[model samples]
Target: MTDSLDPVVAKFVDALNSGDRQAFYALLTDDATMSDDGNDRDLRQWTESEVFGSDGRMDVESVSDGGRSLVANYTNSRWGSMRTAWRFTVSGDRISRFETGQA
Candidate 1:
C-alpha cells in the first residue's frame, strides 16, 4: 500500500513509476506470463501497450496477498488513466504470472 517498497508488488509499482526497466524486469520470472484485459502478452509486449510508457506513472492504492497483488491508479498515454488491479503469482523471488483488468 502507498507504493511502499516493502513487498515485491510495491517494488514493482515503484519500478513502473520510475520507469526503471531493469528493476521492472528483475521482478519477473524468466517465463513470466502477463495479460491485460483478456489477451495474453509477455512482459515486454505488455509494457509496450501504454501503461508502461517511459513517462507513465502510477499511484498504488493498496496491496494484498502479502505483496503478491495490488490495486492502483494508473496513468498512461493510451488509456489516459484509471484504477486498475494487478495480481501476481510468484514462485520464490520471481513472478510467474501477472494479470490485470478493471479494478
Candidate 2:
C-alpha cells in the first residue's frame, strides 16, 4: 500500500495480503455492506467464499477520491487475475460499504 491510500483502505489491503481474517473483519462496521459486479452481496458470506476462502489479494494500480476509490490487479485462487475497481464508504474509523467489479 502507498502513503496516498486511505488508512482504512490500506489496512484492509494489508489484511488481505497477509490473510489476516480477524484484522480484515475488524475494519468493517457491524452492518457493513458490499456489492460485486453491481449485485448486492452478503458481506460476511462473500468474504468467506470470495476473499478468505479464495485467498484473494489486490495489487492497487491507482487510487482516487482520497483513496476511497481505486483500481487494481486483483487476484484469487478461484479467479486468477483481473483488472478491478473498488470503491469504499467510511463511517467513523470503519468501512460501512464497498463496491467492487471488473474494471
Candidate 3:
C-alpha cells in the first residue's frame, strides 16, 4: 500500500484497517452518502453491515486527484475481497460523499 496520500484519506485508510468505527465516522459528515455497486446506502447501516462486520484491510494501490480518489486491493474476512475504486468528496474537513465499486 502506498504511503504518500492525503492525511485525512490516510487516516481513513487506517480507520478501516483497524475497524475503528468512531474514528471512521468522525471523518464523515453527519449525513454522508456512500454508494457501492451503484446502490445508495445508509452510511451507518452499510458500515455496520458490510464494513465493520468484516475485518478488512485496504491495500491502496494508487491514489489520484490529490488523494480524493484511489484504487485499492481490499481484503476481508467475510467476502474474500476485490479490487475497488474509492472516491471521496470532502467538504471542509469531513467527507460528504463516497462512492465505491469494482475497479
Candidate 4:
C-alpha cells in the first residue's frame, strides 16, 4: 500500500528543490521546531536565514518513513549529505508541531 505521508513528503521535496521559502514555510506551522546536527533552532528562523543566505542550497535525495514519522535525505551546499527526520503533529490541514533531527 502507498504511504500516507508520500504526498506531504513529495510536496516538501518539491519546495526544497525549487528553493521556495514561502512554499516551504507554508508547509510548517507557526511554532514549528527543527533540530539539526549542527544547531538547535526554530524552523521558521532557520528557513528564513537559509532562504536568504549565500550557501543554502538543499538537494533532497529521498524521503522515507519509520512508522510514525517521515525521514528526508538531503544534501546541502554547506552541510553535505544528511538524513533529517520530520515528526509531524497535524491539526486540521496544518501541522501543529514539527520536530526534526538528524537521523
Candidate 5:
C-alpha cells in the first residue's frame, strides 16, 4: 500500500519547485539533518541558503514514500536531474532527523 508520508513528501517537492524557502524550511525540524551519498556534510540548515540560494530552480518529477522514508524525483539547473531519497525520523509532525541519498 502507499505510505502515508506521500503527501508530506509531495509538499516538500512542491516547495522546492516553487522556490519557497520558507515553506521548505518549515517542513524540517530545526535540528534536522540531510546528507548526500558520501558527502560528509549535513545539508539541513544550509540547504535553503546555500543550495537553493536566491535563484536556483527545481522541477519535481515525482514523489514516493515508504512510511519512514521519502523519495523525490526532480531536476535542477545546478544539480541536474536526480532521484533522491530522504529518510525521515518524525517527531510530533516534524522531521527530527533526515538523510539523503541517491534513489
Candidate 6:
C-alpha cells in the first residue's frame, strides 16, 4: 500500500512508522496546516504530542485521490487505534496541509 502512495505522503507515513522526526517534518511545507475531526490545529504542536511524542503509526486500508487520501487504522499512545480518514493537499513535492478524523 505504501508503494502506491504519493511520494510525499509515503515519506510521511514512513517517517511515522520509523519514528523519524526529522523526516516527518521535512515532508511538510513550512506553512503546513492540519485539522483534527474538523477543527483547525496547530500543526507543529499537534505533530509533536499526537505523533512523534506518542508513537503514531498507520495501517492503510485504502487509498484515493491519486494517493493523497487514505482510510487507515491509525494508532498512537494517546488515542489507541481507530479507523481514520486522512487527506493531504500537496504543493509541488511538499504537503501543504492535511486533515484527519475518525472514519
User: On lDDT, who's better, 1 or 6?
Assistant: 6
Residue 54 Cα positional deviation in candidate 2, in Å, after optimal superposition: 1.2
Whole-model lDDT values for every prediction = 0.76, 0.92, 0.85, 0.57, 0.60, 0.92
TM-scores for candidates 1 onward, in order = 0.84, 0.96, 0.91, 0.61, 0.64, 0.96
TM-score of 6: 0.96
Worst 10 residues of 1 by lDDT: 1-10
lDDT of 5 by residue, 1-103 (tens): 2235455555665676678878877887887676667464666444654357644443333434456665555455566667776666666656666666678
Candidate 3 lDDT tens digits, 1-62: 45677677888888988999999999998889999888999888877777788777898988
List candidate 1 stretches off by more than 4 Å.
3-6
Candidate 6 ranges beyond 4 A from true positions: none
How well does model 2 score by local distance difference test?
Answer: 0.92
Task: Name the candidate, 1 or 2, with the larger TM-score value.
Answer: 2
- Greater lDDT among 1 and 5 belongs to 1
Candidate 3 ranges with C-alpha deviation above 4 Å: none
Residues 1-103, candidate 6: write the lDDT tens digits: 8788898899988988899989888889999999999999999999899888898999999999999999999999999999999999999999999999999
What are the root-mean-square deviations of the candidates from the true structure over C-alphas?
A: 2.1, 0.9, 1.3, 4.0, 3.8, 0.7
Let me know the TM-score candidate 3 reaches against the reference structure: 0.91
Model 6 / residue 13 / CA error / Å: 0.6
Residues forming the 10-long window of minimal summed lDDT in candidate 6? 1-10
Error of 4 at 48 (Å): 3.1
Per-residue error for 18 in candidate 4, Å, reads 1.7
Deviation (Å) of 46 in candidate 1:
1.7
Worst 10 residues of 3 by lDDT: 1-10
